[model samples]
Target: MDNQTKQTVSQIPLLTTKAGPRDGDKWIERMKEEYTSLIKYVEINKKSDNDWFNIESNQMGTRWQGKCWYIYNFKKYEFDFEFDMPITYPETAPEIAIPELENKTEKMYRGGKICLTVHFKPLWARNVPHFGIAHALALGLAPWLAAEVPHLVENNMIKDK
Candidate 1:
């Protein structure tokens, strides 16, 4: 194998062992490449450290707000909670959890594993192989955050109204 190909192969095990599914090797490589580019973009743009958002694991699957934002209860009809994203990227969907809510759980589906539709679906679809991790995360997370913020939605609507 060529040196580049050998290097790629060597990296696969490390990613797969942590995430799972050999199919994710390609996705992981793409993420690594994209992350490098994103880092460069941030640096070139001279982005402020505060501009970057932080999301912890444990709150991966569901939608939540800032460190102490609200979440959708769906049960008590309350959607006020804070959540974080999962650790695994591209390969596995994040696991969203509500630390304040008892018996609260965020999963992809009923008895399903954590899998972000925007992240994993496009990656697996044969017709769409051009999507990358950073792009997917940006698209999905942005909408999710907007949805969780009623004031933001209300402000936008009022401006339109």
Candidate 2:
């Protein structure tokens, strides 16, 4: 067997004493990485008509909330999402919610939590080490909206707002 070098992780300054030493470091790194990815996602897709979306992120203690807007079929749909890094994040997955959209789809819980599909869940699990809220929104919610909302409108599933 070949010997591998150990990678050192720095302690996160923002973490409180309640946060365990090494685990907090990992969580902070993952959070920052995901947040950066989300920003890059918006920048890269800013000009693309079909895939264009805007995001505003706010750091709230350990959680970050993102306000996202996208245009589909010439109509604008806005969403407020909360991204939380649980102690088990990247291993179990992050907690995300869209509290404003209600009675929208079977995939959504009554409390505004999105129930990701089997397809995306596996993909997320495989890439959790690097995946973040941005990935969830871009790869998960974006496509879900593109495919589901049209049907919701056509079949009269969505309520008039």
**TM-score of model 1 vs. true structure:** 0.34
**lDDT (0-100) at residue 58 of candidate 2?**
46
lDDT for model 2, on a 0 to 1 scale?
0.55
Score candidate 2 by TM-score against the native: 0.69
The number of the candidate with the highest lDDT is 2
How many clashing pairs per prediction, in order? 13, 0
Q: Per-residue lDDT of 1-161 in model 1, one digit per residue for the tens?
A: 24632333233212122332233565355445544544443343233332233332222222324332323222111222243333444344433333333222232334322234654355334312333333333333333433433543344421111
> Residues 27-100, candidate 2, lDDT per residue (tens digit)?
45555565566655655454333344454544433565665555656676666777555666555555567777
Flag regions of model 2 displaced more than 4 Å: 1-22, 47-61, 157-161
Worst 10 residues of 1 by lDDT: 12-21
